[model samples]
Target: MGSSLFSIGLTGLNAAQAGLVTTSHNISNAGTAGYSRQSTVQSTNPGLFTGAGFFGEGTKVDTIKRAYNGFLTNQVLSAETKLNEYDTYSTEISQIDNMLADPAVGLTPAVASFFEGVQEVAANPSSVPARQSMISTAQSLVARFQNLSQRLNDVRAGVESQIKDTVTSIGTYAKEIAELNHKIAVAQQAGSAQPANDLLDTRDQLIKELNQLTRVSTTTATDGSMSVFIGTGQPLVVGTNATTLAAQSSRSDPSRNDVNIITQSGAAITIPENLLGGGKLGGLLAMRSSSLDTAQNQLGLIAVGMSTTFNAQHLLGQDLNGNPGTNFFTPPTVGVQRFSDASTASPQVDFADVSKLSGDDYKLTFTNTTGGYSLTRISDGASVTAANIGLSITPAATSTVGDSFMILPTRNAAANIGVSISDTRMVAAAAPIASAATSGNLGTASISAPVVSSTTDLASFGTAAAPLKLTYSSGNISGFPATLPVTYTPLSGSPITLAAPVASVPYSSGMSIAVGGVSFTLSGAMQDQDSFTLGPNAGGVSDSRNAVQLGNLQTTKTLLSANGSPSATFQSVYSQTVSAVGNKAREVKVNRDAQESLVNQATQAQQSVAGVNLDEEAANLIRYQQAYQAAGKVMNIASKLFDQVLALGQ
Candidate 1:
């Protein structure tokens, strides 16, 4: 009986020692990151069988179980990922908001200044100082465009660098997680009843870190290994193997970087930008492809619209030298067209009408062999019929079916926009042609200002066939040679006449007429022998009619067919872009705040389950120490009883 008591006492002592050690360990590592509180699991040893029921033996330690909840861990990871996503998105969009809305340095002031200068030139058409000021303002406007475009490109470059760094970090995390998976599986298999709790905690911590960079979904296998996936179930880690991710330049746009997974055999699988959502990397990718890209393109659209419309109208007027005005601002080009297939004939694309531009990239594909083509606007995935928009795509006669071309209309327009003419004298401020009656005319007949109805008329003015004479007759105007086929519209007849007889129109007071593509009004009573001369304006330095029209372009609906709207002005489009970015930034900030709150709640819940508590551990330490002392006392009593029995025998 004494021997059995001693044995039970020793067993109790061993179990109590283990409990004390575990409690002390918990107290020591309470502040350690990723450390789960451990407790000693005790089980009573099988009681010895006796005729009078079973006699109790002693307690034995079963295992040390870690405090953990898988569900709560997953919740923490999800919340962390969402918070990172919105935080990153908000940070990126704020840069653009500040750029576009800035008072002193933004495009708004430059636009207003440029138009104000144009108005000044209209107020003083013959003043060289006013024209010079107009030129200076135009140059300043171009500089603003170039500076803003470069800043946006810089932002893009920064995003690319961040993406590359993020990809590297993700790859490192994946490889490390895979290595931990191997270690964990081996340890769990070797120690079957007791899992490798500390290793599991380390692995979970690494997954949380990875979630901060990009969203990841995890699955535990039966063998105690984890599999991680990202971006639409692309495997990042599977058991002991991990796939690496690389940041590569995009195929279509070399300036942009795209993410691709590198397989074990060194094969790359490109991940679409849209599929990547939730976390820092997701935010950066979304900003680059959607918000940032849209902002830059919209700015380019404003530049293209203003430059093209102003230049076209400027060309319609006469300059100080009595010559037609040249292009005032450099026109934006349809950036390097990329073709999907080889074709002998390439299509030429130009902005035929600024009012019809939608500021979207396009894809042109030949549908059939008979010169039929289909154009698709990439922004909203809207199909653009040839007749609907002003983009002119002239395909080569040899262009066959299956030929495809990518057209980026406004992507790089702002960067390429510049001042085409440096001389202020080239600024058109006068009408190309001036109408007048001869000084020796016999009648009170007078002519209105000549309007060049078409580019054909402007080019033909002052030519060998121009400066034609018109002699009034009894009932009709004569002097137009009958041999030459002429287009004449009577006062009350059809609006258009193709090659009609010159004398077919009946003369009337206040009659409108068009000859050789020029339109003018011949009003007042005319004598039978009255004559008028139609010629180009040789000196128009004092004229400001064209300058007035140029100034009017500021409020004109130049950017057209945007979002199904018939037209939009330069300021309206830019304002819309600014509003969009501001709204997105605010939205992201609110979402980030909400997500952070959720993360905090999840962390607290997780901590309650697995975190160490000093007060609880201290109590456990005291209890285990007392139990150990009592077990030792029991052993001492057993020893005393054994000594008395031996003395009795002696």
Candidate 2:
């Protein structure tokens, strides 16, 4: 009886000691991150059975249990990853938002100022200072575009760097988690299938950290090791082995960085970027794809549109040097990124029509014979055949199926754009042709200045020495070249085309006439035998008609629209870019806030289940202390009883 009492008291003492040690451990590690509250699990030893009845033996500690609920933990992790994603996106896109939307630094004011200078030149075509100022403003505008493009390029480089850094961090965490998995597995296996509570907590913490960089999922094996996966179940860690994630140059565009995983056999597998979602890496990619790339393309589109339209008009005008104006701004070239090395050189991409340039990159894949190549609009995933996208894509000769290319029509236009001419005299401010009535006219009729829509026809019509003389006879204007086409539009009626330039049967006051490409307005009545002359505006120093036309281009809808029209202007496209970035920034900020709240709530929920509470641990400390003392007292009593039994034997 004494021996049994001593054994029971000793077991009670041992159980109480375990309880104290576990409670103390919880208190000590309360501030440690990822620590789950642990407690000793107690079980009474199987009751000793006798013929009469069963007798109670002693209590034993089953296992040290970690207070963790996988469901709640997973919920926290999910919310945390989403919150990180939004936070990263919000941070990254705000740079573009502030850069494009700010009134002082934005492209809108620069464009307005450039057109304002053009208006000054139009207002005084002969003013050297006005022309100089226009040139200066043009330079400033080009500088502004280049500056903005540089900023965007810098941001892109930073994003790529950050992606690499994030990948490296993820790889490091993967390796650490793999090591922890091995450690925990070995510990548990060596300990009667019991969990290594502290090691498990450490591993879980590593997973939580890894999730911040990229989303992750995990599974536990029967050997107590966790298998971690990311991006549609791509294994990051499996038992003692870890897969390393790396960032590499994109196959289609080398300037772009894409994420991939390195396998055990040293082969790299590129992860489809769309499937990799929910973390810092995902946010960076999302920002680039959704906003950054669009902003740069839009800016470059405006640059190309402005330069192309302005240059075309400038070419049509006569400069002060009596020469047809050259390009005011250099024409922009298209950018191409090839996928393979077997290229017969990427096809030169030029703008066939500036109005049809959509600012979206086109993918040209060589299927070898679907008319040599297929063009796809990257922005919308719509197939645009090479014939209709307003791009002159000359197919490559030795292009194999392994070769593909990305045609970025406007992506780098702004950076490469420049003012082509430096001399202010090169500014085209005069009309190419002039029209006037003969001095001997006897009628109150006057002819408007001739607009030479086609310089070729203007060159063919006449020279300033001998103009095309039109005589008003009865009701017809004659002396036009018979080979050229002539059309007349009455003020209140539709245009009527004469069957042949020689057969002008009718004429009226307030009528518009087009002879070949030259057009003029005839207002008021012309008496019999009154005459007008159309010829080149040679030495017309004050001719500002073309300058006026150039000024009018400021408000022209020259930028491309989705419906295949020049529907957007330079200022409006920049405004659209600003507005898009602003709206997206606001959206990301809102999502970041909402997701952050969710993260907090989820963390609190999970913490409530597994978090160590100091006050509760304090209560346990005293409770276990008392139980230890009571157990000691029982053991001391049993010892005394045993001593008395031993004395009796003595």
Candidate 3:
């Protein structure tokens, strides 16, 4: 009986000691991150069989378990990932918002300055100083474009570098997590399937860290292992194996980086960027596509529109040196990239009509269709009509099915724009053609100055030797180009075509007529015979007709037709870009703030279940200490009884 009492006392003592040890451990690690509160599970030892039925023998520890709630923990993780995504996106796009909206570095001020210079020249076309000032302003505009382009290029470089670094970090986390899985499984198997609480906490912490870089999904196996997946269910880790994430150059454009995953069999598969969402990586890519690319492309759009239209009008004008103007700015080239496995059917861009150009990237996919290729605008995922883009595509015989090409029309136009003419004498300020009624005319009929528009389909206009002549007789105009047709636009009607050999036409008081490319207006009464002469503007130094046309381009709606309007001017396009980025930045920031609040709520809930509490641990410590002392006292009493029994035996 004494031996039984002593054994029970010792068992109680051991159980109490265990409880004390656990409580002390909890208190020590109270401030540790990710430390869960642990508790000792006790059960009565198997009672000894006796005549008094089964009597309670002692207590024994069953297991050491942690206080945890998986549901709350996962909620925290989900909220954390979304918050990080919005935060990263907001931070990145705000830079663009600030730069684009700022007047100091923005295109608005530079554009205004440039057109103002043009107006000054129009006010004084014969002044070389004014023309030189226009050139200076143009160079300033070019420098601004280059500066903006370089800044965007720098941002792109930073994004790529961040992607690569993030991939490396994710790779490291995945590898370490896989190793931990092996360790955990081994420990669980060796320890009789008991829970490894500390290891589990460490693993969860690692996952939280990984989520900061990229979002991930997880599943636990029965063998205490886990599987991690990302980007449309692509497995990143299974059991003890970790897949490798590689940051490689894109096949379509070697200058750009793309993410790929090396599988278990070592086959690499490129993960679509859109599929990798809800993390820092996703935020960087979103900023690149939505804000950075659009701003740069829009800037280039303004560059292309201004350069092409201005050059066209300048070429139709006569300079101070009595020479036709050359290009005011260098022509912008369309950017294209071919896929690696695509056929060698190189696509070419024909800029026959600059008005139809857009600030969107296009993808050309060749198939077995009648035209053998389809064009899609990448921005809105819409098919681009030939008339809408105003570009003709002719497929080569060598073109094969599945051939793909990326066309970037205005991607680099800003960077490529430069002044083509350096001499101020190259400024075309006079109209190329001049019109006057013959001196022999007797009627009150007079001709307006020719407004030469197009240079195509027309030969050299009137010169000193042979002036193109027109006659007004019987209220009908005659003497148009004999071999060419004419286009006439009535004052209240659309333009109509007249067949070649246009002998005569009954004229109205205010009639517009086009012979070849030159258009002129005829108004006033005509006599029996009145003749008009059309000739080149020779030595007209004070003519500012072309300068006025150039200045007028500032407000002309020639670009950004795709941005919710039929046409938009340069300043409007830039302003729209700024507004879009600013709006997006504000939106993302709001979402981030909301998500952060949700994260805080979820974290607090998770901590309530798993986090160690010093106050509770202290109470447990005292309770177990008292139990330990009482157990020792019981053992002491049992020792005295056992000693008395021994004495009786002696």
Report lDDT (CA) for all predictions: 0.83, 0.87, 0.85
**What's model 1's lDDT at 556?**
84
Supply every candidate's count of residue pairs whose N, Cα or C atoms clash at under 3 angstroms. Answer: 0, 0, 0
Clashing pairs in 1: none
Q: Rank the candidates by TM-score, best first.
A: 2, 3, 1
Candidate 2's TM-score reads 0.97
Model 2, 33-141: lDDT tens per residue? 9999999999999888889888889899999999999999999989988888899999999999999887888888888899899999899988999999999999999
Residue 229's lDDT within candidate 1 is: 93
lDDT by residue for model 3 (279-333), tens: 8887887788878888888888888888888998999888999888889999877
Error of 2 at 422 (Å): 1.1
Off by more than 4 A, model 2: 369-371, 497-502, 562-564
Candidate ranking (lDDT, best to worst): 2, 3, 1
- Candidate 1 per-residue C-alpha lDDT over 1-650 given as tens digits, one digit per residue, 9 for 90 to 100: 78888989999999999999888888998998888899988889898898887877889988888898989988998899889988988888888889988888789899999999999989999999999999999999999999999989988888899999999999999999999999998998898647888898899889989999999998999989999998678889999999979998765466878898877798767798877887899999988877888888889889989998898888888889878888999977876465534463567777777677666677778777766778888667688865566677777666578777777778899999999877888989887766668777888878887765444544433542366678788877766544344555556766655454455455677777776656787878888778777777776888887898899888988776766554788888888988988888888899989999999999999999999999999999999999999999999999999999999988
Q: After superposition, how far is residue 346 of candidate 2 from its true place, in Å?
A: 1.6
By TM-score, the better pick of 1 and 3 is: 3
lDDT, residue 550, candidate 2: 91
